[model samples]
Target chain A: MRYELYYWPEIPGRGEFIRLALEAGGADYIDVGNRSEEQGWGIAAIETFLGGEVTDFPPFAPPFLKAGELVISHVANILQYLGPRLGLWPGDEANRLWAHGLQLTIADFTAEAHDLHHPLGPGLYYEDQQEEAARRARQFISERLPKFLGYFERVLIDNPAGERHLVGETLTTVDLSLFHVVEGLRYALPNAMAEAEQEAPRVIALHDRVRDIPRIAEYLASDRRQPFSEEGLFRHYPELDSDG
Target chain B: MRYELYYWPEIPGRGEFIRLALEAGGADYIDVGNRSEEQGWGIAAIETFLGGEVTDFPPFAPPFLKAGELVISHVANILQYLGPRLGLWPGDEANRLWAHGLQLTIADFTAEAHDLHHPLGPGLYYEDQQEEAARRARQFISERLPKFLGYFERVLIDNPAGERHLVGETLTTVDLSLFHVVEGLRYALPNAMAEAEQEAPRVIALHDRVRDIPRIAEYLASDRRQPFSEEGLFRHYPELDSDG
Candidate 1:
């Protein structure tokens, strides 16, 4: 089935998470908002999707996926729905729930990362909130990063199968999500992530292993893998980074 | 099965949403953290649940419900799991997904409400972030509040079943959550919510109707239903509330 991904066109933003899964699975999908304006897919299309009158399943925000008649939103929820369908998660209900729990944690980390730059509010520009951002960045880099990373590291080490994957032995959407968090932290808090790597070696190793996955490798090498920028979640403000 | 909910005692906080459902359903559940300190239950117990070294299955944070072997975290996920078990959701898978989508949105709004006071970072004191909080509050009151409320209002209106409930004719966890958001917003952003209500009549009606549900009425009247406080998500900061 052909999947339609609705998100802001210019920025990879949250939509990239969905894109990674689709690309990794080689699933037939269309980035609806990214299509050419002449093809009736653009900013207006996204706005209409957001404000349209005929929404049976209205999404609070974007990074929503429409498959057949099912329109799923919320990144973690969307991933949960897509995981089994795309062979990105375990088939068991318990395992799926565990994976979802892990995904929610990743989402928490992602939200914190975003807040470091936009602590004042997403509706305002980062520059306007830089002072608050700086303060938030300190807490994020010092306290939250290590806490979250350490938890994941322990999860990996404590895994009955091994420390290779987040949930199950094989790769899952949680692994992809964990990799994204690591990559985001590296981009946004290079020094803190680098210093904390020793404590979270298993999580780091998982990141490396996920990068080696064939489809993921190809996707990362391709143009579709948008480079992290100021507009995205992991924006680099020099003050946010730590030496140790 | 007796359910054990692990969350901080005192404030209604995030745990109240779960409490509302359990109370409404007349389910046998224990507020583990609210129990006496000497009984290995309280804030310490909550911490143990959060920071424990359980490898079998771990909850990243509290407001998690432990039922049998299943320990569910993420308020929305917990509600989703409980919604079915408690018969608070439609049995159909697609409808369940939709209901979950609504819960997730409420979770999002709840997070935003928390951020209004702690906009700089969760680690820092509100006083340290007061300036930024003011700015963030303005955006939340003006933009996010209405956007979320409007979306839910639209969803209720668009529901093929009817507008009496969020999902269908019957009350679901989503309806309870929407009621919580409306109550929280009115407490937190009274003027703003009042102004926005003109455009979101369906959501207002749903909130009012949920309060009138027999079980819900009893729960609200009972001491167990903690009053909204400055310590909770919906803090009544006058600066944040605007008629505009």
Candidate 2:
């Protein structure tokens, strides 16, 4: 069954998390919002979903997935729904719930990362809040980002199953998500991230290992993988980067 | 089975959501962090769990629920786990997922509410970032808060079952959560919430209804219902509140 993934056409945004899982698991899915209207997919479809013009379960925003009759939204929610179906999560209630909890924490981490560039709110431009952005970024890099990444590092090291994965000692959706978070941080705050990863070697190693997975490697090299830019969650504003 | 809730003792925090569900469902549970060390439950218990010294599936933060054997964190994750067992959600796969999705979005809304006051991360005191907090609060009151609350408002209005609930017509956990959001917003941003609710009468009505439910009403009236204070997720600062 082909799943329909809807999100903003440009900028990886939160959609990339769901995309990575789909890509790594080799699921039959279409990035609907990224496709043209001629292909019967576009932002209009997403608008309809959000506008409550389509299904009864209206998504509050994009990054929603349409699986047959079900419309699931919220990055963590969507990933949780897709994780088991795509064979990207261990097929067990205990492990699936654990992976989902990790995904939710990752979602929290990403929102904080996004706030580094937009400390005021998404309504305001980065330029409008550059001073606030800089201060926020300083606190984020020095405290928040490192704390979060380090937490995941500890999770990896302390995993009872093994240090290989966050849950069940196998590749799960959470591992894929950690890869995206680490990747985004590296792009957005290169100096600070380089230092942060030194303290979170296990997390960094997981990032490298996820990137090397055959399907994920191919997807990264392929044009389908959207590049990080100022418009996305992790923006490389040199001013926002605290030199490690 | 009795449940154990681990969270910061002084503040309601995210654990209140779990507490509300347990209260409404009349589940036998212990607020572990609030218990004394003599009782074998305290902040130390939480620290042990989070340190990954006891549980293999370590929680990134508190507000996790400990059932028979499952230790679940993330407010949404814990709620999803209890929602089924406590009969707080639809039992079927599709509706259960829909409920979980709404819960995750509520988690996002709660995070935004928290950030309105602590935009620079929670490490620093609010005064250290009061200026940024003011700016963030202004943006949040004008743009983010209403947008999120309004989205739920629309969800209440557009529910296929009826305007009485967020998921299926019965009192799902999401409906209770919506009530809490409305309650928190009213306490935090009285003027803004009053104005916001005008455009969301149905949501306001739902909040009122949930508050009046026999179980919830008792819970709210009892000492167990912690009053909103500056220490909690929704803090009332006259300056931060807008006259919207």
Candidate 1 pairs with clashing backbones = none
Q: What is the TM-score of chain B in candidate 2?
A: 0.96
lDDT of 1 by residue, B93-157 (tens): 67778888788888888999999999977787777778878889889877888788778878887
In candidate 2, how many Å is residue A52 off?
A: 1.1
lDDT of 1 by residue, A34-87 (tens): 788788776767677677554677787898888888878889888988888888
Look at candidate 2 and tell me the lDDT of residue A5: 91
CA lDDT of B98 in candidate 1? 83
For candidate 2, list the clashing residue pairs, or say none. none
Candidate 1 accuracy as lDDT: 0.83
- Scanning candidate 1 chain B in windows of ten residues, the lowest lDDT window is B48-57
Off by over 4 Å in 2: none
What is candidate 2's CA lDDT for residue A57? 84
Error of 1 at A8 (Å): 1.7
